[model samples]
Target: MRNNGSDVLLTAIAPIVWGSTYIVTTQFLPDFSPISVAMLRALPAGLLLLLIVRQLPRGIWWLRTFVLGALNISIFLSMLFVAAYRLPGGVAGTVAAVQPLFAVFLARLLLSSPIRPLSIVAALVGIAGVALLVLTPRAALDPIGIAAGLAGAASMAVGNILTRKWQPPVSLLTFTAWQLTAGGVLLVPVVLAFAPHLPAPTAVNLAGLAWLGLIGAALTYVLWFRGIAKLDSSVVSPLLFISPLTAVILGWTFLGQTLSPIQLAGVGFVIGSIWLSQRPAR
Candidate 1:
């Protein structure tokens, strides 16, 4: 069993790595369709992990793996891409930001995690912070996009809860591999149906894909699933704040983005919210 501090840190690494996706997508992968990019990232990573672990799901594990894969990866990612395409980046981000709260609700209902008043307040504050931090004044709401974004959040939240509910019989490595493969395979038809013509691949594109697959998806997810197994869903949930926080930092450092006063305050609020959510119930 991992120590609490180590589990927290390991769980954190997943979102931090995910936060770099914006930079990687912008800098390394340009002009690629979102679905195609997702397919590349997921399928290759899943295959790579399968090769390394060499364990296939058996009996009921197959169904559970596919369900987890669809919820966590295929369906969640599909809706996310839809929201990103239909809505402004800021609007989509704000909508997706409510995921931690959803996780909290699911945890309380399903995992029986204590529903602390402070955690609820923290989630609300975190949502407000994300809105201020990411939502621009000109951002307009598209109902379909908004729905997709919320659904995406809910999908992941439920996935997190279900993962906790269903313990894996195999090692985390093999279990993680199974979900990734199942999810990636499920996404294949979606990619074929929606995005048939992929962009021409370059050396840089391949390199970026490799980085996203190997490091971002494979390794980070291993850490993430293990954390889910060991930690409370609510505890693991709030750590997602690290993703946007890291994104804000990357934007400032690498892209010369500046934070407004409101955004700076939002950052503080988000940090505080994450801290509050992780605290033991009083």
Candidate 2:
């Protein structure tokens, strides 16, 4: 078994890598349709993992994998992309910050987990920090985008909870492979029907897609699923704050973006929230 601190940090790699997705999507794969992008990102990585594992879901697993895939990958990515396309990045991010908060209640309903007051407060602080970290005063929201963002967050929260509830009798690698492949398969028809018209991908586009598929989806998800299995869902959920924190830092480092005082304060809040969430229940 992995140590607690190491597991958390390792799982955190998933979101930290994810923080780069925004930059990659905008800079390198700007022209692809969101649905097609989602499909390509998930399917290829999933296939590669499947090849490595050399196993397939059987019996009830087929259903479970598909359901989990829809919740975790297909629906979540599609809605997230819709929100990204429709709303300012800041607006989309702030709206999605509700995820950890939503997970608390959902866990109560589904897993019968305690409604820890501190956890709630931590989630609120995390939301505020995300707003400060990512939201701009000029952020504009579309109703559809706001709804899609919430749906994406909700999808992910439920997926996290269900992943905890339903422990597969398989390795984390196998489980991750099942979900990703299933999710990618579900997106097949959607991509065919609704994928936006775009020009052919250049070599740069292929490189970006390869990064997203291999590193962003395949490697990160193994860590994520393992974390969900080992840690409390509440603990893992709050770690999502790391994604935004990493995003802001990347912006400063690579994009020549400057961090204001408020954003720095937001970083404090995000860190504090993660700490509070990980603390043992009083």
Q: Which candidate has the highest TM-score of all?
A: 2
lDDT of 2 by residue, 1-282 (tens): 223898888988988887777677777887887788788889989988999999988898889899999999999888877776777555677777899999999999999999999989999999999888877666676899899989999999999999999899899999989898989999999887777465688999999999889998999999999999998888889888787677678778878887889988999999999989888876
Question: What digit string (tens of lDDT, one per residue) describes model 1 on residues 177-264?
Answer: 8887888899889889988888888999888888878898899989999999888776788787777677667778888877899989
Off by over 4 Å in 2: 1-3, 196-198
Clashing pairs in 2: none
How much does candidate 1 score in TM-score? 0.92
Global lDDT of each candidate:
0.81, 0.86
Where is model 1 poorest over a 10-residue stretch in terms of lDDT?
Answer: 84-93
lDDT of 2 at 177: 91
